[model samples]
Target: MATLDIKLKKANKVYKEGELVKGVICVDAGRSEIAHQGITLIMDGSVNLQLSAKSVGLFEAFYSSLKPLQLINYSLDIAKPGKLPSGRTEIPFEVPLKPKGNKELYETYHGVFVNIQYSLKAEMKRPLLAKDLQKSCEFIVEYSNKDAKEKALSKPVQFTISPETLTNVKEKQNVPKFKVKGKLETAVLCITKPLKGELVVEQCDTPIKSIEIQLVRVETCGCAEGYAKDATEIQNIQIADGNVCRGIPIPIFMIFPRLFTCPTLSTNNFKVDFEINIVIVFQDNHLVTENFPIKLTRF
Candidate 1:
């Protein structure tokens, strides 16, 4: 017999731009377990296409061909994932996002290798009980480079906001309020220990390495939606060993575009969901996105 299930390493049912998702895909193989080949782990997501171009040379009149193209997909494959005996295994993984335009591969004749918009599906191909147990997840590849700007913000301060979703609407048409608003706060706790994460790059042609525990800040972030939002800010934050630079997470709070709505409809109350956005900056410049939700509400 065969079975399949998804076990997320963190409470990560959602994600933000440039944020890394952590977890394991667990698969159990029942009778007919023998002749069982190892397992494969796959990760993928569908994304919206975003392309931009610049004219550095000719083509000022014919239509510039020097354009930029980026794909909104991140995934990895574990050839022989970890096994848990009895034909069951939980494979761990880490995927880095090259958010829109962070960098792209191009050609002179093809313009930009634009990724229009495609669905992403990362799964495992296993043989067990005629049913397949796999770990699959989805994420967004935003057109925002806001994550890098806040890198200078120092830390040790654990920062996050409440209310994951922020929504407003017009009264008569049940339309979500176009310009909703909310507040977020940061905290400085006396940490009895430190948070850690690993960076793996096998293409380096060298051995993997790790650094000591020297950090500056602990940041948290989330998102919001509306035609417009409140001029947001963070305060009262504290840190342990390092300084709290901006005292908050990057993009502070991002905007998720409206996926469903009719211009004729209006309402003031709706759910604006945001999972906690977190970052732990290590002395070596290793950024770790923590598990937290700064979900908020505006009524």
Candidate 2:
């Protein structure tokens, strides 16, 4: 293989925080002749926010809540891609970055800090070489514009994992206890189809019904020994009604998808872990969160 090196006009340059930049990547091949060369550029950033709520009941002190927005990945881009020949070749690239969110949203607005950046990566072959070589470089970005908005919302939202908890009296009940005239394989809660509907609930009732609680998930991960069975269940606030029972309550949604159970957690290993999608249920058109505790303990 021959020797090779790359050169850039300006190793790095900063644009107005939200501005754009135009540049090219150059390759200089020495004794070695290049077979094929490709270039790629990437850019990214982050944003955060905090929220809170307070409400009261008939005559009692209500509830208060707070939440924080995690790091949000602004964006990732591949500016240019091309194959290069021997000798010196240049591949140009341009990137347009967006300004960070505003400062007013914070109880105390901390001037938003916009971080700009760029990266260059290339792969080339060696002259009559044994193996090809690759290299990369990254540059910084500066803020260009600051168009901050007061992130406002009047709706309630929560992100969480759901759980599946169907007490089957596993194994120990040796005999088929249910003396029903139907098929022995029939599941009491056969979710042939995911019941979809609105989830907006007004309030929860005293002794909720079986259909009141929505099953957020029935997920399973793999175990080291092999595929046995690993699952978790969760619950959340929702609307429910059955017979004379009514009000905002917990609802359980049964998700029995065609591929509900995976053969492996991930094809790479034979661990007992499998991927089970968490199905959601809606009450009065509003989606609910799996916010309760439901874990299984084996002897």
TM-score of each: 0.32, 0.27
The lDDT for every candidate, in the order shown, is 0.31, 0.31
For candidate 2, what is the TM-score? 0.27
Off by over 4 Å in 1: 31-38, 45-70, 81-84, 100-122, 126-135, 140-299
Could you tell me which 10 consecutive residues in candidate 1 have the lowest summed lDDT? Answer: 105-114
Candidate 2 residue-wise lDDT, 1-299, digit = tens: 33333344455543344445556656665545545433334443322211111112321221121112222123333323334456665656555544345421111111111111234444454345446655565444322224222121222223233222223324423321111010111112222233222232223322223234333333221223222222332333333344222232343343433222211112221112211122233333332223332221110
Which residue runs does candidate 2 get wrong by more than 4 Å?
A: 1-12, 45-83, 99-133, 145-299
- Residue by residue across 91-181, what tens digits does model 1's lDDT show? 5655554444553311111012112222234354545653434544443222233422222112323322212221221232322112112
Clashes in candidate 1: how many?
37
Clashes (backbone N, CA, C under 3 Å), per candidate, total: 37, 44
